[model samples]
Target: MTTHANKKTALVTGANKGIGKAIAAGLARDGFTVFLGARDSEKGHAAAAELKAEGDVRFVLLDVTDSASVQSAREAIESETDRLDVLVNNAGIASAPGSRFKEPAEEIAASMRIVYETNVFAVVAVTNAFMPLLLRSDAGRIVNVTSKRGSIGEEGAWVGRPNMTYSSSKTALNAITAHYARSLSATNIKVNGAAPGHVATDFNGFRGTRTPDKGAEVAIRLAQLGKDGPTGVVFEDDQQLAW
Candidate 1:
């Protein structure tokens, strides 16, 4: 095994493609030993191989929705490194047909529950599981991938009244970030939510205006924040977003 005792270590979940892949690439380029986590073994290894030219990148199979998978991922990473400097919770799902208001109540609940399983509860689960490794670092960073539509303070001007699926899941994620930051205030951990606005990805059928790299900019930046950087907040770029 290549020794990474002196390098910064990071993990990006759902990093087989899209913005998560971009963030993993960025971190690798920044000289961090990046673990690209994904549910698909083939794709995860492929992505890690593709990123090898950039820097040190490895694959970690992670299914955020399953506690066993989450535990296994944590163990896998822990075996390689004693500490984790950055963790980007970038796995999420888009809205389904039944997630809308006019849909049947049961359908809406099922859709929202699926979304929440990955978007909200999964975040908490992942963070809590890997938190020990994060705290081992001198400057721990947690970047929760959220959305602008999730902001309750701002009206959804662009995509008015986002359904209970994707948008509401992010709203819950933001609140979790706030509480997490508060809980870890005295520690080295800096927890924050990142809104990768309108990224063109398969998740949205390529309707977005921004590229995956552009959408990943905020999460990448947040992951590398210094000890003095802000926590318990949301940001898109340099601009802080409304909660």
Candidate 2:
């Protein structure tokens, strides 16, 4: 029955490892009570324990792909605090490289469904479910972890990039971010998309040049934005990119 009434609170999905865990750790270090949400209880608790020395950190079971799980997590948070200052949608999945382009049509569709289920649909579900709590905060923020490859404005650069499923899902996520930001413009909440660039994680088979800690930087920055910060934009590090 620990209370987080005096501090800002944040929830980072898929926070058991990788970028999600890094973001949770960063938020905790910034004096926010961070809920490390992970589908697996063991991993989630382990991550929370590892970050215990950093600051206030807790573990919450959250499966972004499941509506029931999402609601339960929301209720769990509500039971602890009336407001959610930050919500980081960091849970995502990608088909093995080249699978989208080399697989059969049916296989490609199935893969797309899997990616969209977590990347796009789950983001909408989680954000919508937590909107009430976000609105209650003094400086609410929503950070959708997206990718530069999802930008249609840069389509020419992706000529041979084998990321049809993953890329398109992020594109949809960016759209969701814009839609939410517009819808909540009159309110105090700020919603934006964050591109972490290519980070070395299990999602990309550890081939990326940067580390998960580096990827979490943008999302952490977005999460800590003040009331005056810009909204409805896609940012990479500190630079705003075309949406």
Q: Report lDDT per candidate.
A: 0.89, 0.88
Q: What is candidate 1's lDDT per residue for 1-243, written digit by digit as tens?
A: 543678999999999999999999999999999999999999999999999998999999999999999999999999889999999999988765444454334345667778889998899999999999999999999999998888765554246643546677888889999999999999999999999888999988899999999999999999999888999999988899876
Model 1 spans > 4 angstroms off: 96-107, 155-158
- With candidate 2 superimposed using the best TM-score fit, by how many Å does residue 196's alpha carbon deviate from the native? 0.7
**TM-score of every model versus the real structure:** 0.94, 0.94
Candidate 1, residue 159: lDDT: 61
**TM-score of candidate 1 on Cα atoms, chains taken together:** 0.94
Q: lDDT of model 1 at residue 226?
A: 89
> Model 2, range 167-218, lDDT digits (tens) per residue?
7788898888998999999999999999998899988779999988899999
